[model samples]
Target chain A: MPAGASTRAGSILAKPDHRYAAVSILPSVLVVFAVVIYPLIYAVMMSFRDSRMGVLGGFIGLANYARLFSDVEFRLAIVRTLVLTVIAVALVIVISLGVAMVVNERFRGSSFIKLALLLPYALPGTLSALIWRWMYDPSYGILNAVLYHTGFIKEYVTFTGDPRTAMGAIILAHVWKFVPYSAFLFVAGLSSIPPGLYEAARIDGASSLTIFRKITLPLLAPAMQLALIVQTVFAVLYHFGLVYIITGGGPGRATTTLPWYVYSETFRFMQFGRGSAAAVVLALIMLVFIYVYLVALSPKERTVS
Target chain B: MRRQDTISGRRRRKAVWLALMTVLIGMYLLFPLVWMALSSFQDERVLQSRPPRVLLTPDIFTLDHYNFLLTGRMPETGIMVQAMYTMSGTYVLPSVVNSLVIAVTVTLGNLILGIPAAHAFARVRFRGNRTLFMALFATRLLPALSIVVPMFIIVSRIGLLDTKLALMVIYLAITLPFTLWLLRGYFAHVPRELEEAARVDGAGRFTVLWRIVLPVAKPGLIASAVFAFMLSYGEFPFALILTQSLASRTMPALMAGIGYYGSSRGMVAAASVLSFAPPLVLAALFRRQLIDGLTQRFE
Candidate 1:
């Protein structure tokens, strides 16, 4: 059978014109190869050699990897990245799910709320951090003002300056920026559930909570899993802008996630070999993340296949 | 009758609660943008006030920040004296134009390549199609940091660093995968019978795609276009690393350079609002297409 032949085509599967298809597909393949695949291979190779400021040095197999493991800061950065990723992903899921349910109710003004929800994510991440930076300003932040005026605080607090609240502040900005996208995912998930299922449950005298638990929660799992996995990847790899702008990964290295570590190591410290090695570790970690997602999705995928 | 009345009453209460919840969430989502807009309008001195002016009276609100950004003229009262000194002859507007250039060019590049490739993948099955599809999407799996060093080295070697062409090439990499995947779904959604009918009328492959399939897939095409635009417009990492000057630096990097409303808080706020205007407006107007494109099932 011709590969990927449509069902409409008869049993006499004619061979596809590979030349035509290849010609049509070559430009995109080449672009991606030059920009994405080639760079990736280069990065992997660079991880094996000692380089300084993009100049190649002698091949030092796994030396950078060894240093990455032994380095105290890199270890701490890994721990911090894991902590942030877990907490941020969890918060994003819960908050987005809750908001999705509310919006799915389709109450009056829901459309306006939907429009408003896209703002944070749509605005550039750097600017969102800046906006939140103003909101979180210690002496003159609107957040402090509102809290003090509302009698929730006794004094002005440095939200991003204190190590205790720095990462929390960053997480809050992240949630603000990311929740909309995840909420949209949940909304899509909710929309996909067959209305007949809910109607059937209601006809069977199911309570609202029972209907949700039995009919909604199980059905929403795929989208929920997708959102969680994607957000986890983002938390690990992205959020560099938030970390860079708000705290500069500062207040004593309080917010230096893995991406930030790569940035500072390679760009600031000019340790190209070490940075490339760290980047490889990050890529490996991400592979594990994707592998988990794949493993989780495999059963569903197999059923469909 | 009494039970019926009670059930309606319960629904009314639920609706009321939902409305309340939506209002609270909307405020949480909107207040930051509102604050930025307000700060942009207020005088720099007014912004520094303790408890910063929440409601703008006519007196505190002025267009000085915007005027300065637009005209390059400093206010006589010298509210942003320090900012003016630092930002004199700054190419804020030109830089934003550079951003537009990169975003528009990259978006067009993506669609041109993405549409044909997606059509090929969806319609013409060939050897290695599945493998190529997997590889194309796999490119997006790794973090941008993983390849930034190599990409930088590659771009600089070609001597395209800090040029819009450099940005176009890098952003093409960033946006093409998503565009290809989404447009492939769009192409697949076009009923096969439509193309076959056109072919029966003697239309060639390209003409069938161009005439019959594309018209039907226009909404999806627009959605993918918007997505491509926004990705390049708001992308930060590559923008930060690959470009160093106004020669090619986009809004995100430029805004970051302003130090998050540090000293020139007012001007930066204005620039932020200005920078966000196009994508935000596009997003608002095309909300439906964007949402459908994102949340639509490919399968």
Candidate 2:
């Protein structure tokens, strides 16, 4: 009976006291709430009301959102943003993977080449965009000059000026800026694979292509997913500098993305309410993507750790 | 002898392939930068000349554009007097100073605050830690555009508007989540046995952290600081909207205005090269640490 009572006491002692953990995490929680959560809530509240650049104009539930669907420019902006995000993310993944594979191979000056590739990412995005803007200038730009001299084309290509090439130019800029980052991540992922696994596969008569497809691809999924998610969020919200400098969402509004659209509304048009509403929608869409991505990943990557 | 010849031939073929690949990738990456540097020295007449010249020689160099920019004068409109007034009155120098001050301060601030937070999250597991850590990671996932307007209001209401402190605080908001998440991962990877051994030798928590954890996590800390500085330095929209005067503007914003108004392309290129200096220097100095910090996994 005494032994049984001792075991009962041990069971009681084993229960976790959560208060200490709560206190330790409290400060971080509060910081996040104040900076991230509070602003998020405020954004949502402002979206429902007619607020103008930090001033409370009035309450108008769903009216701003309704106006968004009705506005032709805003609708077009959504479509354009989706297309840009998809294409840019896809190209960045493919090109970066290709670069990573080459860099992973043992070669002379690989590190130097990798560093050069990452140079644009290290520089400020705004500055890089501005540099490219000069490079894309119609008459004096090096790009047009190169193409003209090479006879790649008979005339100077108005990359950012023409609607057909505007989105493509912006996408190229995004890819160039981010591919190095994705490549770096992939290289890290590749390094983690054990040589033993490859040896075992080779013993089984696996070809190089089959080995990559069967082993490397599965193992690198986590890194790829991480890159894709982060790049998607970044690409979706990739305004403020590049778009502001390169196209300013111009060439007849062909390049106006959701973030650029919000900027134009709040700063240019002074339509804060509508802009806030659009921001709300964009955030919600991003949240949905994150949610779906997490759910999709959980089962497949259960053993990631 | 026949076998040796075959092996040598194969080795030569492989060497050639590797060399070719490296050169192609190198050119692909470096051409734009090379072009920029070349154009910066070229004459304006040459810049406008048909069939533009890609090569730069000493004969093609000129300082006219550089002189124009430094004097705050536009050659097309004779607007030096007006431009100077704008530059001085708008606080361009102050803005650049403010950006540097805020970025440095925030980097230091996050280092101090973030290190402890990361330590606690990594080592001192108490309760609800997983959820709390997840919450911290979630903050980074939120869209910046969604929060910019609200953050503006928050900063304004707190009486921090138009101050470098405002930019610093906002930057901390944007950068802290990332710092905490990244450092926590780094800290978790640090073997706890070392800290435990130090503790057994009568070391306190702070001593154990300083001697054991800090030394091991040096690469991560340096990389995090570099990233923090980059974020704060390059941030434009927040700087543009939060701070009105030229005194509060950051370098990128200053460069933006320069690019928008400058007549000659050489000045813009010069400004671009100048603006890229700080980040490049930091990157080059801590390149190995930066690479390891970014590529290493800690889960």
Question: Whose DockQ is greatest here?
Answer: 1
Q: Which stretches of candidate 1 lie over 4 Å from their true place?
A: A1-17, A52-55, A302-305, B79-85, B260-262, B297-299
Residues A177-284, candidate 1, lDDT per residue (tens digit)?
A: 889889888988898788888888998999999987988988987787778777987787668888888899898899888889988989998988888888888888
Candidate 2, A1-305: lDDT as tens digits:
11343443434223222322344446656766787788888878888898665457889999989988899999998899889888999998888777777777757767876777667668777777877788788877878888888889898888988999988888887777788778888888888888789889989999989999999888888888887887887788655477788888989898998888888887788777888898888888888878877787653533222
Worst ten in a row by lDDT for model 1 chain B: B80-89
| TM-score of each predicted structure versus truth | 0.94, 0.89
Count residue pairs with overlapping backbones in model 2: 5
The CAPRI classification for model 1 reads as medium
Candidate 1 residue pairs in backbone clash: none
Q: State the lDDT at A77 in candidate 2.
A: 88
Per-residue error (Å), model 1, residue A281: 1.0
**Lowest summed lDDT over 10 consecutive residues: which window, candidate 1 chain A?**
A10-19
- Model 2 error, position A170 (Å): 0.7
